[model samples]
Target chain A: MKPSEYDFVAARRRLEAKEKSAGEKLTSLEDAAARVTNGDVVAVGGILFSRTPMALVHAILRERRTGLTLVRNLMCQEGEFMMAVGAVERVVTAWFGIGLPWGVSKIMREHVEGGKVVYEEWSHLALGLRFRAAAMGVPFLPALTMLGSDLVAIGPMKTVIDPYTGTTLAAIPALYPDVAILHVHRADRFGNCQIDGYPHMDADIARAASTVLVTAEALIPDEEVRRHPDRTVIPGFLVDAVVPAPWGAFPHECYGLYEADFEHFDEYAAAIDARGTAGVTEFLDRHVYGPASWLESLELWGAERLARQARRAHELVPATDIMGGLSTPPKPPALGAPRQSRGAPRPPDAFTGYA
Target chain B: MTTIASPTEWLAVVASRQLRDHTTVFAGVGVPLLAAALAQATHAPNLTIVVEGGIVGPRIKPGRLPISTNEMRTAYRATMLTGITDTFLLAQRGALDVGFIGGAQIDPYGNVNTTVIGDYARPKVRLPGTGGANDIASLCRQVIIVTAHERRRFVPRVAFVTSPGWLDGAGGRERAGLRFGGVSGVVTTLGVFGFDPTTRRMRVDALHPGVTMDDVRANTGFEVLSADGIDTTAPPAADELELLRALDPERRFLG
Candidate 1:
């Protein structure tokens, strides 16, 4: 049902009250991990390896639960870790890979080939919109993609005749996960979160899930949270738990935090190369279980490696500044030498065609 | 080999030529990225490229071949950094002109298979399924495929079509209610191919320099028809090759 004016008013009052309430929403990573029972559908927030909630994901792995259904943009990198641990019995995603020589995921490929993992693959667009349908409280979303492609047959999608026009279009059913874990740069005591770079499918999945949990790089004050309310991708009202997890996305980048730890990826890749799925146990021991805490895991990298991973402000550019200052039009391309901006009025883009 | 260059280098050159100046191209990583960057640096400087991961009007980062479309480097100096939904919605509305696709296999009808090799449920090979390649092929006015020329890559029918290219041989996409344009052409290591207007089957428009019809026919698994006036693909000019090398000095894509 559509929310009424009273619902909005009530929600506002509760938020205002929470602002003054004793602020301590920080939960232990282990506690957060325990919430994820077996047979739960978990939607992870990230694209490739960027902004994945690694700390919590590791915690879940340590818990040793099975029968998980993972939903994500691409089942690769960190998602590959989940499959390696035998946590994910099924994956409902678009693409799966580590790129380069290894096109398909290693152990995940084995599990699927061995009839242990059920791979429910769809086009990336279909999966994104399916989450959107859940967010909007709709049964399905009509999409222009997958109608012509064979993904409609292999993946979980159906074609419906567009009621407005007599044309047939592909529709993906809603995918509301039991729990959605997002990694953010900062959050407050109230659980309001801020993502540094691209939200990707973070905000959508957070809303689409039955429960919203977040692992943040830092826990900021209420003023810092209110400083740019517009930047809040996950609102306090929707967020159920927040864990203060610095370097939460360790191997993967957290945008402004650092770059992807290719050293670790390379090491993992080398292990796979040496012994296909046989090397998984040693890999898990070294990476997932070896370290007691997420921070202690840094010992594997040592101090010098950490220094190189340090982030500079300028290098950590925002994908969207909730502060909303940047509206500058794209500058013309810089050719041969650095392009001298002669203030030439460029032509309209191809979207409108040449003017 | 085109004028005795590697297959990938030839494919990159031909793919870049397909892009028109003052148009938007929705492209992914590797050769597609190189093709767009090459076109920008040389003939089509005004070409706007939308990296499928949310970058619109992207200028290639000086020295990197982005592995994923959403790679942080892909967002560097981009015109607009929007989310996934907004970027693709533009294509759905028929805004983008060209969408570049790289596929595991290309069938006679220009249909692509990136899903699996053997079968759907139980497969010999599990190729990475469509990662917005379906949307690119379905919505763009024209889709350009860049891949190597191998008998295995060219099949009579794709094991599973991940993206449509005239679905069946002719009128299948139209019958399936595709709103916008279907596959226009394919640029491979050996030659350039386009769908025949009547049959909608892949037909050779041009061959790489020094490559013969026999060479092209031998590489393809299915029947390949030649157009009435086919041209030998022009060899990569020094300037174009230089730009491609500069963009990817590491030879990440070229190698």
Candidate 2:
């Protein structure tokens, strides 16, 4: 093959063309998640609160796909949402944010207690290594971290003791997910995706999965992606299906498009606080159910509807949205002072002026 | 008896204790990130917090938050640029003092299972497997296991060995002549634990204020012996809390 034809860029382009099958599109998030089978190791991408494919979570809940093993960089509220709905079998993640706002609540705790779920924690770097392994198709990379410490005791799930070195190197096997679900800011019709901000390892995850389902806020033409391929995070070849599911990210923002609807999230969290899952389910039904797009759902739950929901739920404005309590690290009062009394935190209203 | 406190306080207190002056602490993301910052702010003022991306002595503004490793901006004071593998080399060479980590499953033997919940060949769940953890766990002079302590987490045996703290026993570690540093203690929200010098298995060393040994025993899945008389961990004073908040101004670490 000619150098021009066999180059990485050309190879990528050819692969993308082959991956894009005509008439391959997801009807909805439910249909998308239903395609995944039980006992499949899946990878989903998102950071702490941004860029989560919330539509996919709704779809999984609607279809009730259970016994899934999820491998991801971070598992927070969205991961907990699956666990809460009894959809996830086991989850391996670096760090799981605890507390109510992030969805690490009674249900997640129940699953952990019931032995239905296995939680794996690691340093973020370790988490990144597994993604790199999956991306590179390596069996397992050599690692020296947590060798003699308690961390070594936890996740290496695979171990090959080196006879020569007499040192244990935890062999963290590569993860090849059945499907890698990614929600991004933009994509071409051929499923070439781009991350406007911090991509958070989604591209590597897409490479590691058997099939890739990409949901983007908007779909630009293939030519546009071709024009600036470097901006494209996922080459089209890795993608199996592309759905222009606007507001697919929902609670999570799609960078530059819209700020996270912290108010709506707050409403959802309030419902969770007041009536637990029932309230959250109702919130999901109102905002995330049906064929209507997220934009439509947001319109339906505009200021008036949310206000009514907030009043009816009898919960204060969700805590996650109202950021006025400014509890930052106190500045040194001069060069050195022991510290002032950290008594009862000042009321949120005290910083209302700042808000 | 003292009650273990919130996650933020837990991170701040651990960081305050472990970090020392002029030491180079390799920082991973999450709690380790938090602890490194706290150590730099409190005890180890000159401490160089080296991240895997190769930044050092991060000019951490006063905060209870961890700076992002992916941010090229955070790599300012870094002496060199390297991948996750190189960071472990630094640890292996005794270039590190204290390291912070968390795990999914921890056994009495301090054998962690971050890989799977079942057998190695056929796992109930395959997590994003190990990275520098194996190296950091083995090489760091002392490693601190930071995670919320629950019954499922503290198990009798880990499903897979992600990292080995004490290994089968302390004697086993000694006999094998492992160059990697052995586990010193486990810091959890509820209490702190250390391996018996002889058995190499974990024993309760201290409990956080507002927590009891009974609570620790109830939460732990294994049979853990308590220290002759365990003491309570100090609660984060105002300064500590302030420092923590500064690190994560948005309280992203709280949830």
Candidate 3:
């Protein structure tokens, strides 16, 4: 039931109070890494390349933690974020999508191929599985999908028989992560976070975790929260801690804050198409690996670097305006190669109509 | 002989091989598209791939095609342009042989749910809208489900009904007199499973190569039976991969 008499003004004040309080601690993301221990199950929220909380993950890597398992719906670009920093021992996910600058690095792929880390693959639905189990207050759910399909064996699955029917069924256990991290657009005191844009599986991850860490673009007033309650994806009851982090979804799109590095993504996809993972590795090291600061990622691809990368990668670069002053590198030929003037006289036989 | 391969590759190979020669197979987005394209190239050269938007065997671009309508790019040469309803009608009239789909939840009885992740009234999560999955799953001669393996999706009960597989449970389907052959098999990123003949309940019929029984059980949501000496599913050959690529230039609708 909708609350009667919305008090947006009071909600706004409450949010401000929460943000001011969190600002006092100002703990470096690196310090937060200490909370994750070896062999702990972790779930990081976000989808494709949108709203992913890389800032928190970056802090974990800075601490160089290891022997921890990551469970989630999507974990790709930051895979190297786990591998390079030695913060992860194994990864359980539905699929891995890595691009050039922030995607799966060469080292991570090699690790997956070399068995340095266990690659426990699953379908995108698995993310929903965890959340559904959490919401249902059940241990696990049964299913009949992907049974005869390749996911069983190719995924290296083991089979068991249902005692009830004596018929065999594939049993995939429900995932329960000890920690879940998410990045959102706004949050109020008490941890009710709102996502202004496409929210992939962020809410689901938040529900499945014992502790939820949130990084928001801003801390709105409690009154504003009441005014726009529909925007809140996670209720205050589910969140543990909230930090206001700008550009939190760095190298990825954050609804109102920063646009996705599409030019970089194109470059990364080309790298995967051309040199495979090695190219992807070199690209990540230059942009996502070194500093935990988001500014550093932008700096790594400063104007000149982005142009050069785009040229070599043969991609259509984004309009400079969309870049929001990353220090534009000398502009290269505009992407789609500016169309020739329509009024120009056609060259002698240039347009011979095909027979 | 060929044996089980990667989940994605296995799906491409098996689905392609199963489609008859020159048959027009109507596939939903994702694995079904991969299966149809691979089959067209390797097994059924004359097969016509009809995307929801009417593109027929048009070259598929890369990345995920979130909706069935995205196949329009490949439907360039399609014999017909149709909407979701039109496509389902084709399946109902016996104009299509195979239908590939994905689901959010499935029960032992073969019932499928792509709507909500939890129980009917209250749900933990609500997914994208269901298009023609119900009609295709219920009307098609053979329906192939392609999704990843998990306990949540392979649950014993679905919170909602987006598509009917076995209706209630064992014999629930026959009792309801549900028309159309039910789900033929499930191809996951892990292994392949089929329904038991007697119980009409889903079961593990084979495993992909290098995968073990324990591995399958570890990820599956429900208890499953194994064949006396479960055989290994065949892997895709180089030619099959090339064909798959040809049909899907951008690698759209795949893992």
Of 2 and 3, the candidate ahead on DockQ is: 2
* Global local distance difference test of model 1: 0.74
Q: Could you arrange the candidates by lDDT from highest to lowest?
A: 1, 2, 3
List model 2 lDDT by residue over B1-255, tens digit each: 124346656755765586678877766666777777777778778887776544456554333233334332343334453434345557767888776776778888776765545543344455445444555666777777777888989988776777776777756555434555777778887877888887777888878777887898799888898779888777777677666666666656644
DockQ of each: 0.49, 0.19, 0.05
Sorted on DockQ, best first, the list reads 1, 2, 3
- Tens digit of per-residue lDDT, candidate 3, span A196-244: 4235566756755666688765555566677767767788876767765
Q: How well does candidate 1 score on lDDT at residue A234?
A: 78
Clash-forming residue pairs, model 1? none
Minimal lDDT window, size 10, model 3 chain A = A321-330
Best by lDDT: 1
> Regarding lDDT, does 2 or 3 come out ahead?
2
What digit string (tens of lDDT, one per residue) describes model 1 on residues A226-266? 76788887778777788877667766776644567666677
DockQ of 3: 0.05
lDDT of 3 by residue, B1-255 (tens): 233344566666766676888677767666677777667666577887765433345544443232323222233234443322234446656777777776667777676765444432233443332344655665667777877777767886665555667665566544433434677888776677888877777778777778888987787677787778887867777777666555545544333
Error of 2 at A297 (Å): 3.2
Q: Between the candidate structures 1 and 3, which one is better when assessed by DockQ?
A: 1
